[model samples]
Target: MNQTQILVIGRHPEILATVIRLVNNNPAWNATGCITDEEAMSTFDKQTFAMVLLGGGIEEPSEDKLCAYFTSRNPDIKIVQHYGGGSGLLSAEIYEALE
Candidate 1:
């Protein structure tokens, strides 16, 4: 089976690193981390991602716009929410559903 590709939008280096590690550690994911919304959007426009991780610090308007754009472009992509510091953003059920 092919691993799912994930795009992460976050500012903090530590949080991005942790998320990259988590997603990469999972046998099912191919994680790629981006710091800025522009970079994330650029990546999104270039390639298809199975999921996207949105950091709490990210501007909701920009994130929402991106989500809408990506969903319109490809409805199969899932957007998962996350906090800036670490985990616990989504409930286990939501996480499992996103996964």
Candidate 2:
């Protein structure tokens, strides 16, 4: 079976570390973490990833551009916008819509 891959984008060290732990532990995703939209985009452009977990708590321009760039490059790629703070608050709406 092909392993699923994900790109995680966020600036919060603590939160990012938590996500890295969660993702690394999950059998479903081979997750890679990035600190900025630039790093995320650079990595994305170089290889194929099954999903992107965009830190919704990040700054506007960076988030917007990353979303737009990813959408434009691979419209099929799944994105999970993580609204850092609480786990229960994460939006499934975007995931559902993509499905």
Candidate 3:
């Protein structure tokens, strides 16, 4: 099976790490976490991702910009807003986004 590439954008290091770990738990998914907009953009340019999870820690304007950037680059890319939740919720949200 092809692993789905997921980009996680957040300002909090712990949250980012946790989300990355959660997403990576699924063998079908590979996740990359970025703490800054610049890093996110650079990573986005370097690879093709199936989805992007914008963490609650990001500022509203930054999140909006990142969503716009991702959609503009690939209209089919799925963008999901992720507030901190349990592993089950995270998995559900990711699965929903993929569908």
Q: How high is each candidate's TM-score?
A: 0.79, 0.79, 0.96
- Point to the candidate with the largest lDDT: 3
Ten-residue region with minimum lDDT total, candidate 2: 88-97
**In model 3, which regions exceed 4 Å deviation?**
none
Q: Model 1 TM-score?
A: 0.79
In order, what lDDT does every prediction score?
A: 0.75, 0.75, 0.92
What is candidate 2's lDDT per residue for 1-99, written digit by digit as tens? 565677888898778878766666646457688997778889999889878888757888887788899999999888777776553343343335336
| Per-residue accuracy of model 3 over 60-87 as CA lDDT, tens digit each | 8888888888899999999999897789
Alpha carbon lDDT of residue 81, candidate 3?
90
Name the regions of candidate 2 deviating beyond 4 angstroms.
85-99
lDDT of 1 by residue, 1-99 (tens): 887788887888887888788667667668788998778888998987878878667777887887887788788888877764434433342357565
lDDT, model 3: 0.92
lDDT at 28, model 3: 96
